[model samples]
Target: MFSSLKIRNYRLFATGAVVSNIGTWMSRVTQDWLVLSLTHSSAAVGITTALQFLPMLLFGLYGGVIVDRYPKRRLLLVTQGSMGFFGVVLAALTLSGHVQVWHVYLIAFFVGVVTVVDNPTRQSFVSEMVGPKQVRNAVSLNSANFQTARLVGPAVAGVLITSIGSGYAFLFNGLSFIAPLVGLTLMRPGELQKGHTVKRGKGQLREGLRYVKGRPELIAPIVLVGFVGTFGFNFPIWLTAFANTVFHGGAGMYSLFNILIAAGSLIGALLAARRRSTRLRLLIFAAASFGLLEVLVSFSPFVWLFCLVLVPVGMMGMTNNISANTTVQMAAEPAMRGRVMSLYMMVFVGGTPIGGPLLGWVTDTFGARVGFASGGAVTLIAALAIGFVLVRVIGVRPKMGLRNGMPYVELVPRPGSRAEGELASAA
Candidate 1:
């Protein structure tokens, strides 16, 4: 299960990343709370979130091209350092008592610009840290690592907010970046398994689009993740609204809600790490179930019950996350991996600029429950629609039955070579 941890370089990267990830989560929670404190409006918070993700929509494709052309480690150093610097500046502004909502928005926008490169770079970097054989396990472990941070960071930020201040949480997050920098510096260059970086050329960005446009296996998962990620992953907007508006609670309740989801996600990631296969059918089922759960949770009468509902929601959500990530990474050629992952992320995260504010508006206008239900409903509908297209239109055979005393999903192309050869494995 922990095979990726046996690799020396990957072990170092994971350790440092876990620490950094904790801080990242802390900053995210504090940022949202700080905005809400200033304006007392969910729309303001939504705008902040939107501004932060807007760069992805604008330059994400170009960022992918740059990542494919450059050395990922070097790019990470630049991007990560820039992010830490912004974290420190934001901290200073908050602590000095002169910070404004506009200031937070500006800093968040800068951070988003850095993330446009960092997201794809860091993802494709996993394949380098651990060889191809361990990519799936490494990716799952990374998701687990981030989820574990979510479990701790939000709760810690909540305590820090009530006890100290949000400024100090930002300060702590700024300092946390040092660990990952140190880890990157410590990695032995000789130990790295590097993929071939694409040479810069005209039309390269378009080349990537064409590549993804042709593969049903690839496009299928990307489309699924795009819908789910845009709509299904706006927890900050919904949960904050629920905690403050519905439950009449504070950061503690918000932290509790986040913690339950993280717990489920962590378990789900661990389970995904044990698997060697990434399948489209699994993606469909997990996403559909995740959406269905979110729809149900939106109607819960109590905060505690709502919190309990997040467990299965998080589990199914994380399963879809791992499966989709592994599918895109494994299916793409090494040379095009950066651009491919960038496109995957473009749809998955870039759409946040659109979804976040919409959800926040719904939460602000109708209520958190309605906002949550809308997102789930979109996700479920998309999954069913896409599944039908893949089965009936694209001739995908998603067969699930007992084989060798085990039930599995077999994804096969229509006979006579209509699509990619059998690509899925034991479900």
Candidate 2:
């Protein structure tokens, strides 16, 4: 499971990310609580969340193109620095008591803009640090490291918010960037693997889309991620509202919710790291399970019950994510890997912008319960739709027997045993 750490550069990257992700999570919890406290409106919280992810929806495709054309390491350095600056500005504003909802929204938008470029570059950059053989392990460990930080970050943020202020939490996040900056600087240039360079030409984005358009195994997972990310995985947006409105708890309860989910996510990532294959069927099952868990949690009457449900929610979420990521990376041709992965990131993260506000509006208009339940229902429907689409489009059929209480889809290639050919022809 820890096989990727055998590489020195990845070890450094992983170590820095562990620290930085903690700070990132810390800032996230504080930011959400701060916004809610200031505005006392779920709509404002959703807008803030939308601002943070809106760029991914608008510019993510372009960002993928940029990741394909540029040196990922250099791109990361610039993006990371930009992110740190935003953190500092947010901290400064909050510290001065001059911060308003619009200020947070603007800063969040700025951060999202930087993230539009940063996210894809960072995702694809992993393969450059560790070769393709270790890509799966590296990806799984990356999630593990982030989720591990998640567990610590929110717990600490809760205490810190009760002690110091939200500004200090933001400051810690800003300062946390230093570790990654130093890690990047200290890395031996010789150890860095070069990423794929795309030929500069017209219709490059179209070309990348066409590439994914022709792969069922790839498109299937991407669609599943889009559904889950857009609807089911937005616990942060709704959970904050739920804690405040439904549960009548404060920031502490919100923080506790995130901590529990993160703990579950950490375990999920570690378990995924042990897997050798990236199966599409596994992704489908995980996504379906994640949706079902969300539905169950929506009905929970108490904070403890809600928190308990988060364990399976986190588990299924990480399973779906890691499985989708590994499948795309392993399936793509080396030359198109960067672009393909960027497209994947675009779908995965980009969906949040549309989903966040819509769900937020649901919470505001109806109630937290309705919002949560509707999101889960949408996820279930989307998962079922995509699963059927995959079977029809890929010419694959689920096995007659149930495995793990879910229908198992087996890849059924045409007579030539060329699934790609079948997919391309169908497309």
* Model 2 lDDT per residue over 206-235, tens place: 888898885566777888788888888777
Among all candidates shown, the one with the greatest TM-score: 1
Least accurate 10 contiguous residues by lDDT in model 2: 399-408
TM-score of each model, in listed order: 0.94, 0.92
Model 1: per-residue Cα lDDT over 1-427, one tens digit each = 8999999989988998999899999999999988988998887888898889889888888889989999888988888888889989999998998899999999999999999999999999998888777888999999999999999999999999999889999998988889888888898978999567888789999999998886776888889989998899998888888889888999888888888999999999999999977778788899999999999999999777898899999999999999989878877777888888988888898888899999888889998889999999999999999988887766776443445543333456766443544333322
What's each prediction's clash count? 0, 0
User: What are the Cα lDDT values of the candidates?
Assistant: 0.88, 0.83
Q: For candidate 2, report its TM-score.
A: 0.92
What ranges in model 2 sit over 4 Å off? 392-394, 397-427
